[model samples]
Target: MLTVLPAINWLSVLVAFVLYFGLGAFWYLFLFPKPYRISLGRSANEPQSGNPLYIVGPAVCSLIITLTSAVLLYALNVTSYGAATLFAAVVGGGYLVTNTVNIAINPNIPRPFLYGLITGSYHFVGLLLISLLLVAMR
Candidate 1:
């Protein structure tokens, strides 16, 4: 297994968190908002209250996901600098695409296939990036 220096790994983790959140904010606020509104058939002027649970729940989940991926990458003996860059590109980029598609489709009909496609694609790309980062650190 690759042993990553604590300081470097922590820094990388911080970068990852910031990047993910920033991308998410961008996607929601600019990229997907139109599709989301259209999908829900909601007017742009409607008052939408932010739900604490919704915000907190996703934040907690994202933290767990990042930590779990980091641990697994370490355990799997994959830690390198290149891996970090790759992970950021692939995983982060994948989420960007997935969100775009989800907003574009905004399907009214039950579509398990579509849902699975988006979810699976996002997870796969994210894990790939995470794994690459772990491996590179080693």
Candidate 2:
């Protein structure tokens, strides 16, 4: 019974994807531009890249994450609000946060922990919202 296709809610997935991507935009651009730059070991005065990949890449990733979370929520039959929150927390903290920290542990990321803290927090919150929305819409 691994088929989650029939249980999927496309509308919720769309809304959640928007919320997830929108949150990323707000998080990086408005909320923590300076701190994020510092976490990347870059100065405020440094020239930012205008590459489309920067935008497109994360959008794709967010969509994937959203869709995946939606499938899991439906497949696992997480219907209650409290259960959704707990599931989100577990998935967020366990996979997203841990993976963010792991990705940051590289030579390019001078302040790995700081970067992890910033990005991981975004994913954590995004997952929470996504799961909640999915459950609510279901």
Candidate 3:
């Protein structure tokens, strides 16, 4: 654990976290604004509650995901681009995406599949980029 901690490029992890969080901002706010709302059975122009949790919660979650990915990359000694990509696919798809889809498969989410696809895709892409960055920086 001590060896792995020093080996991690902290700056790269910060950058990856920023990229992942920023991508989510762009994704939900700009790219799929309407679709995301529709998935919740809300109108496109419906005003969202100005709740701080809406912003802070996701940021915290993204940070956690980024840190976890960084630790995993270091612990597993992923040293190449191919390995990074494979790591992304397996972790992103197997865990993140699958859990996201499972969460979406609930009565609350009106368009369960669409919501899962959009949200899961975001996590997958973020993981892909973050994993690659971690490997490159390592």
- The most accurate candidate by lDDT is 2
Off by over 4 Å in 2: none
- Clashes counted in candidate 3 amount to 0
TM-scores for every predicted model: 0.53, 0.96, 0.95
Kindly state the number of residue pairs that clash in model 2: 0
lDDT of 3 by residue, 30-68 (tens): 899889899989998988668999999999999999999
lDDT of 2 by residue, 1-66 (tens): 449888788999999999999999999988988888999999956666899999999999999999
- Give me the overall lDDT of model 2: 0.93
Model 1's lDDT to the true fold? 0.53
Among all windows of 10 consecutive residues in model 1, the one with the lowest summed lDDT is 109-118
Ranked by lDDT, the better of candidates 1 and 2 is 2
What Cα-based lDDT does every candidate model obtain? Answer: 0.53, 0.93, 0.92
Candidate 1 segments whose C-alpha is farther than 4 A from its true place: 1-8, 37-48, 80-138
Q: State in Å the error of residue 136, model 1.
A: 6.7
Error of 1 at 118 (Å): 6.3
Give the CA lDDT, 0 to 100, for residue 99 in model 2. Answer: 99
Between which residue pairs do clashes occur in model 2? none
